[model samples]
Target: MPQLAEKVPPSVAGAVLRAVFALPDPVRRLIAGRAVVRDGQRLALDAQLLLLMTRLEGASLTGATVPEARQGLARGQRYINRLPERPVRTRDLAAADGIPARLYEPKGLAEGSPLLVFFHGGGWVIGDIESHDSVCRYLAVNAEVRVLSVDYRLAPEHRFPAAADDALAAYAWAVENAAALGASPEAVAVGGDSAGGNLAAVVGAFADRRPDFALLFYPATDMSVRRRSRELFADGFYLTDADMVWFSDHYCPDVERRTDPKASPLLADDLSGFPATYLVTAGFDPLRDEGEAFGERLREAGVRVAVRRQEDLIHGFANMWGLGGRFQEALAEAAGALRTGLL
Candidate 1:
């Protein structure tokens, strides 16, 4: 059964949200309280209002059971993610090792369009294809490429390395079957947000057959370290420290194993041959510093890297397209990067 929040109809929720956000900027700012300034970045007004609304609703992922957390995220996605009704065709497919996957192909794409193998973010524990359906759709239509959204196995049930293994397998499957999917075999990219971003980076770092490009959105690179951003945005920033502990506990229970390169790809020895990459980090996200550090490491290793810091956004802004503010703007830049990189 779904939670009470999940019971709210998406239409009703959407209407309420649209009305609330339609409030004047000054009113919204007043309601959201004073400006949140940290690390020399002011949180965007829209993001501030969203955070305030989330808190007002008393919703949180920190203390929920696994099922409850998943339900909460499902409800949130339903409320905030507006699916694009563009002429993209979707088909269910099985990825490598029979993992469930969905392919999003925009209408009238060229025979050799690029394909992005995307993993949905949920700390490797909660998220699935449905939670990120709109993200793939937006990317497909805007980037003018097909997207393979991989439903990778989650944590507690699958544990450390399972999600990474599945991500690599799914990406490999996309690369191998690109032509069949009407995608160019040589132009497959790997991407994801948050935990999905971590998995994408892992695939880029360790896969036998390299991806042509990598699009990472605030990936959790060095899971073993407690970085400055983690301390700065540890609480009230959507992804709290308690939430991280919960996710890490479920995904990688063995403290000793957290340092493994496959588990913490930032610790990987060689990032030399990684494909051209665009890594985006949220200014207010706990993972921001580490993600930027990974981009620096990639650059140092001779990988072509572009790192964009959406300083006004939060960790999960990639899924906030329904809000139609800075979230959509940030995503549009990312899509443009993908289109250019794959060309």
Candidate 2:
């Protein structure tokens, strides 16, 4: 729960949030509309929908199966369409290893500007460049950097290594074509939200020639879904326990794959030599603890790191760049981090 002083009143954003909160868990689960009987545990239609909505809203679907996760993302797209427009430049480009991506770059860039290669959050199953378009625009314009938003492959259909492969490819493309994008090769950064953040962290850990920095927003660092925060915020406040199970089921159809370090970077043995990192977590988010834990691990491994907890915020607040006053503050903090890292 947020402190009284940090609480946001019932503004337009707050109203929408409240409306989402007001819906019965059963009703929200029905909205997701994906259900299956697993291990003799059958979820009611409403139950599935509620779980889906919670995970999608809170960004806890890092390991969702591709089709079901895409359904959730479609629901999110409908919601995003209801919001007002912000400034952005959209383009289709070839990423590393010929992966196609729809890039969102903010307008008015000078020659040789810094660049940020961003991946959208969706537990590596849902989300696309379009899903995170608004966030990329806000960061590019406010931070005065070129933002290359990647449309990486998702899980289940694409599965574990696919998203990670695409993320690394995007990072490589950003470094290779920085000049063409009017970006300083030495000032390229990589980042994403939720599962995308996990990809960012993993890529940073393994990049042969690492990026200048990394930006993670409410990242899902542990795919195992056994974190204490998962149980703590499992019910109300957003992102329930059922949602995590759904995502994990989707991302890791094979029960044995859950333990793979590639699926959960928190299980990785090494974290040294990654770029400078800026990790932002929402206090009310289920993934909060794991993101914080990852930051601590990075620091322990001698990586330059900074962790910021948005105490009053909920998950997916980064996409709320046009919503409330706090959005500006969040943007400022993120932009400041990028400036310090890239410049």
Candidate 3:
């Protein structure tokens, strides 16, 4: 049986969400219950409220089948995320290796403007271009750049190395077709969140022609070992340990290959020549420590890197930017960084 939230129309859901968020901070916080503090980091009040709502909805990714999980994610987005804003131009096209892709060009974008080759995150199992349409549109408009969002094949169907191969190929295609896309070939960047972030970093480390910049949102840098953040925030905070295990088991399956540099970018032998990067990590995310550690590794390898920890948020905040609040603020900051980096 569908829960009340699952059955509510998007309009009603959005209205209820807006009404709830419009309440004063104190009132909202009161409704969200007490603050969630761990490792000296406090979760934001709004994030807490969203987390509580997620629990009440009762649609969890942890135990559901692949189709059910995908449906849940898409349905949840309809309920919580706003409709994507229209870009100046949007076109469906095939990326490298005939991968499905979409191009978003912002209003007033000049010739030779920078371009971003974006990969959508879903632990390489569930997300798609539609799932990340809002994110690509937000980046395209806010950064004043063109965005090529690739719909790479997902896992449990197309497993390890498939997503990575598609990401690299799509990036190559973007660089080769940059002029046609109204962007400069030399100014193309690569970016993604979670699994997609891992792919972007992999491209940074191994692409034949490196990207000009990278934008990572709380990436899963290492799948080989569970870090402190994984244990500390394992159960609650939206992305649970069980969910991670499910994703990994489906995406990689073979435990022995988990440490491959392609799977775990943090284990890559050299990052000295990697492109400049701006990586964001959520304070309460299981992937937080590994993402920050990857930044440290990049720095040690003489690569320019900026690691920003959104200390009051949870995992998947990047996908929640449509809801406004801190999520938008964080993504806006990344857009500014992308603009500056590509200049």
Per-prediction count of colliding residue pairs?
0, 12, 0
Cα RMSD for candidates in order: 1.6, 9.9, 1.3
lDDT (CA) per prediction: 0.90, 0.71, 0.89
List ranges where model 1 is wrong by over 4 Å.
1-7
* Candidate 3 wrongly placed segments (more than 4 Å): 83-86
Which candidate, 1 or 3, has the higher lDDT?
1
lDDT of 3 by residue, 1-343 (tens): 7777668886787778778887999999888998888899889887888888778767675545898889878877776665446545889999888999999988677899999999988889988988888888889988889999999989899999899999989999999999998899989999999999999999999999999999999998998999999999988798888889999999899999999999999999989989999999999999999999999999999988999999999998878887789888988999999989999
Quote the positional error of residue 56 for candidate 3 in Å. Answer: 1.2
The candidate with the higher lDDT, 2 or 3, is 3
After TM-score superposition, the amount by which residue 235's alpha carbon in candidate 2 deviates from its true location, in angstroms, is 2.2
Sorted on lDDT, best first, the list reads 1, 3, 2
Can you tell me which runs of candidate 2 are displaced by over 4 Å? Answer: 1-72, 75-87
Model 3, residue 339: distance off in Å is 0.8
As a whole number from 0 to 100, the lDDT of residue 221 in candidate 1 is 90
Report lDDT (Cα) of residue 192, candidate 2: 88
Instruction: Flag clash pairs in model 1.
Output: none
Evaluate model 1: give its lDDT.
0.90
What's the residue-level lDDT of 156 in candidate 2? 62
Clash tally for model 2:
12
Q: How accurate is candidate 2 locally (lDDT)?
A: 0.71
